[model samples]
Target: MAEGQRALIVSAHPEPTSFQAALRAAAVEELAAQGFAVQVSDLCAMDFKATLGPEDFNDPRDTTRLNVSLEQRHAWQQGTLAPDVAIELDHLLAADLLLLMFPLWWFGPPAILKGWIDRVFVSGAVYGRTAVFEKGRLQGKRALLAVSTGAPSQSYGPHALNGDMNDILMPLHRGVLGFTGMTVLPPYVAYHVPYVGPAGRAALLSSWRHHLRALEHLPALPMPRLSDHPDALGAGERAH
Candidate 1:
């Protein structure tokens, strides 16, 4: 990641008036007010393509096709990327913290954000297949997930039809971000988004402000398995 107090906010909703837009706007504003540099990438506005190509599967360096797509090469010379996946990676690398805000769709993040990961979180870059204990380049950064959901929190409890919110998020935090060594802070979620009317939204905005303002004082993301296997954390825990 680049050195600086910067955050990258990714919004994947197709409509600007949708609940996601409002939440994303509120997050960026609050973070900005807290004196952090903020960048917003509205995936819909970018018409981001989520599909990976024939070449992405084969690491360009090792393959004859050179994994680098013509589009990526073109963007490289033009000094601009047409969502080649690396652009987001660059921002992720540069930011001190990554604040992901999205609407939960089909029990998880929307397609474009998932697509962003598919394209950018390349195998070699994020991890290694054989060396399960390898370190991630993003080790020192922090990550937080904020989401807006139509389902009421009441509907998500164990007593309710759906499972806990954490159930839906475990794969993301534990399997992905935490697996990569970026400290995964507790998430922020706004439920019943469709019903979180103007007044409720105002309240959420106030809370969001506090979340952003508290970043500096908050403890860094803990090294995974710090206590369960304290010695196993070895070098990575020290970075935190």
Candidate 2:
């Protein structure tokens, strides 16, 4: 809520005129009104690469094999990561609040958004042997998922066939964002987006605006803390 505080919204929808775009616009307007500087990364419009490969690194730790984790660390250390990735990483590091916006595909975020994480979240800079959970580089930041789903909200309920939405998103909440030490907020999900009428869409936008306005007070989702599990750091080191 402080002046000059920054918010970055990374949007992954392909269509520029889609409902998701509207949601993003609403967020921008609301956040700006609240005295926060807002930055947007419209992945689809940018034609963001959705795959990580040799090109992502200028200097690889191992030339014979592509070890993504090691290469990411090396590139991060050497400042040799791909240009696009570096730019996104800069934005990510500067943001006080990170909002991942996308339409759910196959019960998860779209491939582009996933790839954004893969490239921008450098292993050494974002997370490392000792820098996980509470000690992560992004520890002071906050992250929230703004997702759109094709199915109705009922289908994603506690006892619904598709399983609870919270359960479906646990990996991202606890593993990716939280793993980097970011405080994860409960997701803002717009269900049955395509099936909803104009009024419903408007209502969704209103709700999103309300959510953004109250972001400072939103409770963080539960996540693992290093102090609670002393062996977790050792386990990570062993895996590496």
Candidate 3:
């Protein structure tokens, strides 16, 4: 909402002409009009390597042995991470608002987006032992998920066949975004996307633009703070 703020949209739709792509493009235009410097990571266009393995590291101290986590930490320290990961990190660090735009697949993000998180949210760099939760490296940043679902909104309720949308997104909003100290905003979901008529799609895009216009005023979803609880695992059990 602030003038000259930087926004990064990580879009994972494979087809350029898809509805997801149209929403993403609309977001760019709207946000830019609101004085945002926008950048997009079109994952499919980039053909981003979704899997992490030994190849991610150029040189290993012990070539015969490999621990992915340890290797990631080492890479971060040495500034030797994969070039793509490094670029993404730079973009993330510079962003004030981060938008993850994708069509929900099996009640979650696409595999390509998941892999981007796995590789780019490096241990030592984005998070670490003491720099997590309330003290995370990305504490001041905001993240919102702009998601699309093939099913109708009615099917996503608590008792619906598709289960609750909020429950399905908890792992991402709480475990991932909140864990990293981002202010997780309530998601914007467009349901029954494929079945929607042209008018419905246009309305959804209009809603998205309105949402962006008031982004700074939107309340962040509540998240538990690590500091609010005791360090001991069974503290609550002991109290009870």
Candidate 4:
């Protein structure tokens, strides 16, 4: 492991027997092999809370005092979050490369992970003129989505019911993580959960290792600074 570089792997699966844990172990091993420090937060094991409250905003528990600020209120569209989210807020601030490992529950993150986002990706920490991602506080930082899906990849197509897996997780990519300033790399989705046996799991982790190796030499995502904020350019001059 390196002296300062650390990767935080946050897993949100309830069952330790799950292949999700295997995926996490694979990522940790791969990162460690590259001499990167690794930290795992088995959120379910930690008994993570899944609700939000008023104190989360540093205000009294008015039950309706979500108005921490305009930005906070703006995010109320996601609903109120629990106060314990402060703990996650701290962890996120310290991590460099964050790996979110979870199962795709009903086409999205588990309720617990969503709550973590709700609480930790708070108004002040995640938004403002000067934010972690607002102006690139963590511009060089990276995030990867290691998700497990019960449905097959074909089922996630345009005509299928699952919808585009990438689109389904846009909240993590473009909304919370990217909006705060992190560069989201291509997600690693393990589809067809039912067919994932021990051998299949091994193959998945092997592929995961290959992906990690491919990224080992690259320090971070390749997005340009100005490109980080598409809205930064003039309305008429900004190109797609």
Candidate 5:
């Protein structure tokens, strides 16, 4: 049992009655049962700001210019980020496991969740020079995505019309989560959710519960390590 461990569930769905919400609830209950203290961020219910803008930084490093990345690093270091961003950052840093629950839209996450990444994953706090991939600030943490898709399961298969689901999710898994040094667990996806009958929905929930029970043993998806590409480090330095 992971007693005293913390889990953060960030749920993005406009409707509280949606399957995404149900998944979030199930995660909370199961994590709690596993002796984890769970924290929830219901973005829609909270009316979370879905944009990254100047307001996110109270003290800009340059008054005449607005470089989002540089400003994020500055705000993070100065402890002057917007309250909502700061609060979420705290939860993120404190979590042992982070679960992002949302419906797949346009082959990606919703705009709100993207905004959360933009605002909370500050440049300095989450990643910076030499602090990325295996050396990321979140290196010891784990992240999982619980997603619901409108398309049927077969459509997401390797040669299906819609393309492989893993490929579709590679950007997020590798670019965002893995880039920050979090171990990316294989995502849990419920396909054709809108068309699934009640029995199917129940079965998905049951499977999700089972998956959560074995979270600790789940194998991480492959991610690139900076050490493997020593040349990349100099390239990274040049880019910055």
Candidate 6:
């Protein structure tokens, strides 16, 4: 919470005038007010390439073998990662807290954000054999997902039609962020966004502002210990 601490918000909405964009804007303002040096990566605005291919690496070990993870790791070690990936990695490494803002598309993040993770989170640079989960490369950093959903909050639960929101988010929270050694915060969701009126939207924005202001006191979602899952380690496991 120190003055000038950095916060990076990765916004994945395609429309500049969308509600997701407004939420991203609100986050930037609130974090700035709280003395954070905010940086935003508006994926759509940047026209960020979401696909990972040979172009992302400078030199491939075997031109015939197209292994993304291997190439990404090699690129990092050789300081030859694609410019975009390198830049994003720099932002992530410098930030104290990283927020991913996007609309929940079919129970997951937009392809742009997913692509960001695929390219920027290089295997050797970010995580490796022993550098994951509790001992991940970015161990001390924090991450949060601020998402919007079309369904009402009541529609999400163990038995509900949309299923549990927390369960739906476990992939990003535990598999992605936790695997990278970040403390994952509970998601801030703006549900039934299309149905909410101005006042409701305003209320949600207000709550978002409050959340950022009190980030230091917010409890991180509990993740299983490395020892808890010796079989698969940080791989697929049931949400706790």
Candidate 3, after superposition: displacement of residue 41 in Å? Answer: 0.2
Cα TM-score per model: 0.77, 0.95, 0.93, 0.78, 0.96, 0.94
Candidate 6: which pairs clash?
Answer: none
Per-residue lDDT for 113-188 in model 5, tens only? 9999988999999998788899999999999999999999999878999899999999889999999999999999
lDDT of 4 by residue, 1-240 (tens): 355788888899999988898888889888888777888878899888776655454433344544454435444334433435655665677887889999999778999998777666666555654453546455566889899988878988667787777778787787767767887777888888668777887888888778777764544433334445667644543252
The residue pairs found clashing in candidate 5 are: none
TM-score of candidate 1 relative to the true fold: 0.77
lDDT of 6 by residue, 74-114 (tens): 88888888899999999998998999999999899999989
Kindly indicate the candidate among 2 and 3 with the higher TM-score.
2
lDDT of 2: 0.90
RMSD of each: 7.0, 1.6, 4.2, 6.3, 1.5, 4.2
lDDT, candidate 6, residue 172? 95
Off by over 4 Å in 1: 1-3, 55-83, 130-134, 217-240
Model 5 lowest lDDT segment of ten: 231-240
Worst 10 residues of 4 by lDDT: 74-83
Candidate 1 local distance difference test against the native = 0.69
TM-score of 4: 0.78
Q: Return whichever of 2 and 4 wins on lDDT.
A: 2
lDDT of each: 0.69, 0.90, 0.88, 0.72, 0.92, 0.88
Write down the worst ten-residue block by lDDT for model 2: 231-240
lDDT of 1 by residue, 1-240 (tens): 133478888778888787677778777777776666888878888987787775443323334453443434444445444345667777777777787778898889888888887666655555443222226656777888888788888888666778888778877787778776687787788888678789887787677667766776666544454335545534642231
Q: Candidate 2 residues 159-222, lDDT tens each?
A: 8989999999998999899999999998999999989999999999999988888888999998
Error of 6 at 49 (Å): 0.5
- Per-residue error (Å), model 2, residue 197: 0.3
Q: For residues 85-142, what per-residue lDDT tens digits would candidate 3 score against the true structure?
A: 9999899989999999999998889999999999998888777765667877888999
Assess candidate 6 and give its lDDT: 0.88
Clashes counted in candidate 5 amount to 0
Clashing pairs in 3: none
